[model samples]
Target chain A: MYGNSQFDGSAAFSGGGFMPSQAIPTADPSSPAKSREAQGLLPLTVKQIREVFQASDDKANFLIDGVSVNNVKLVGLLFEKTERVTDVSFVLDDGTGRIDCHRWVQESLDTKEMELLSNGTYIKVHGHLKGFQGVKQLVVYSVRRITDYNEIPNHVAECIYVHCYNTRTRKMQDAPQATGQLPNPAVNTPSKGYQPTSSNHSQFSVQPIVDGMKGIDKIVLNYIEQPSCIGKENGIHRAELAKQLNVPEHKIMEAISSLESEGLIYATVDEFHFKSTVNG
Target chain B: MDTSNPAAFVNAELLRMYVGRRVRAVIQVLRNDGGSIFGKSTDEQELVVKGHPPNPPTTFVEVIGIADSNRSIQAEIWTNFGDNFDVSSYNTICQLANGDFKHLFI
Candidate 1:
């Protein structure tokens, strides 16, 4: 009964709202995003997140644009504010709504990335929702400040496009069951601007920092520069690079440190977010 | 960034990001109801009152209150950029004094 709808990663890009764009050269057969899509952990937009908060019943799990999800991915402004309780929280404005993101500090883990975030910045956040004293909040998994302001509009458009795609797919899936007719293969085909999984608005304004690099480092640089815009709020995390490149996290970190020292790449938004000097 | 306590997006930045330092906004006047001219954000997320603000559209405004429902924010005009104000586009930000915007929504 669940054969067609088993969600065994066939719709990897569909669920996460991420398409395997040429921008992200995760050419490796075993990629983290692919695995996550197989696992069905899709991303949610901030506006959809607001709907999650509003539609929740006694802190219940909510659906984001027809997909039942607990995780969310949002892009927005990071405003600087004083520490209210000495606890680390980042307030984000994605134009649709304002959300507070919380990430617990692990003493054993490196928090240099967290320290890199500052106010008056644009950023991308990945995490889930939680309730604090009746107010809805986000418990973030990752946060990066943005450099390319262009990604702002692009991100918004992506959220809308993905939501529409998912909604259409679900409706198509449901129709077959309702009518007992064979599912239409054409229904799963790409929508307008859905080819190659690249965003319609991702024409990059910057280039990769490749002045001096070799082997994996060059490949990593190429991958990080995949996003149409790159800078403080628009750079890639070392871990993200690792997943996309199918490389070890340590390797990406090492490459990043070297590139940073050469002054070839710098943090346009904060320490964690990087942009090539050539782009500036 | 401490994630344990989530509260980094503060009120001050909201004014700047959503509104602006100069409080520049393209306010859509809904109607002029005698005493106070009613206006709102192009998205209708905010309710604005013209002439209620003292300064022209160039300076700053005070965030007075937000509705209990959290649907809107309320502020009194502190200043304006100029006496004459008009918004040409919906998304285009009309440069107003930071004080003219009372309550800012998304």
Candidate 2:
């Protein structure tokens, strides 16, 4: 049994994932799909739309009516004077609630169809409710021109959907498979003297060196400026240098450990410095 | 970049000792978990050896190959410790030229 729900519009799906069957709302018995041609023109107010459907607790399909549209924005088509197939959607704000109005124009709708529905054109849409990934929407069947300028307070003609696809099926075209063989890594070899700095190593070096160390290059320069008798004499004591640099002692210790391991620096007792030519 | 090439990591000083001699060697990478040895004909390829999480001391690696006209075999050991190890670490060792292998443990 469904309990009392707080959702204002017809109860619809609530989570996100594509479930096509649950998306489409059933048409009202009086407004049969077959009678679309005879019921060609029906004048209805926004309030009447709200009275017809009750919000459901189900997670599949729901209806949204009497919602105010908002955030009407536009995107441009590439070729000038050429109308391309596009899909548009807008946010429907109903003061108490909000939902997205999604429109899907099939690829089959050619340039001619786009010409008929130019940008900034206001049209009344007759559609059934559909839900996708728990979001309630109106899957428009047919749209007619609405001469009333007041209906569409905001008009933006923008193509929001872009896809690489086959013209007929609208399915994505397959991209060329990567050669299947690994690329020759030789070409990507690093230049000589170029040393990679690790994020952890740099973080360790910077934070412990200077208060709020902004530039890593500056810290490395500072370290280089203070020759620690790395190669010529006993290396600088890591703990002593860390204190002088005003950096976290632990970070400096870690950096010293890594540098010593990498042969870039040498350690003697508690001191660390650049490796001597003889030792290096 | 191509650490898989055995010649790239071979000590240049050791290589000069042989000059134009062809030496065959098997580079093996031993995992910390006693996993299978990663054997390769050339040191050109990179071998990724992972460390157990939670509390890992460090991961060990070695580049082994023949040098001095196959008269002598050489191995360079290195340690890497962190959350995500760099692929360059493997390549860096492979590109060491002429430098003493002991220099790595400065």
Which candidate number would show the highest DockQ if scored against the true structure?
A: 1
Tell me how each candidate scores on DockQ against the true complex: 0.06, 0.01
Best by lDDT, which number?
1
Interface RMSD per candidate (angstroms): 10.3, 31.3
Error of 2 at A124 (Å): 1.1
| lDDT tens digits by residue: candidate 1, A1-280 | 7767766575564344642122232443544332233223344445455545344453434445454454566776676433433346767765445677777555423165567777756678776665555667776667776654444434544554455456555554453211111111222321211111122122121111242356776776666555453544666666667777899988877777776664445565556666654442
With candidate 1 superimposed using the best TM-score fit, by how many Å does residue B102's alpha carbon deviate from the native?
23
Residue A7 of model 1: what lDDT? Answer: 67
The alpha-carbon interface RMSD of model 1 comes to 10.3
Error of 1 at A179 (Å): 18
Local accuracy of candidate 1 as per-residue lDDT tens digits, B4-64: 2211111222333443212323344445453443455534445544345432323222222
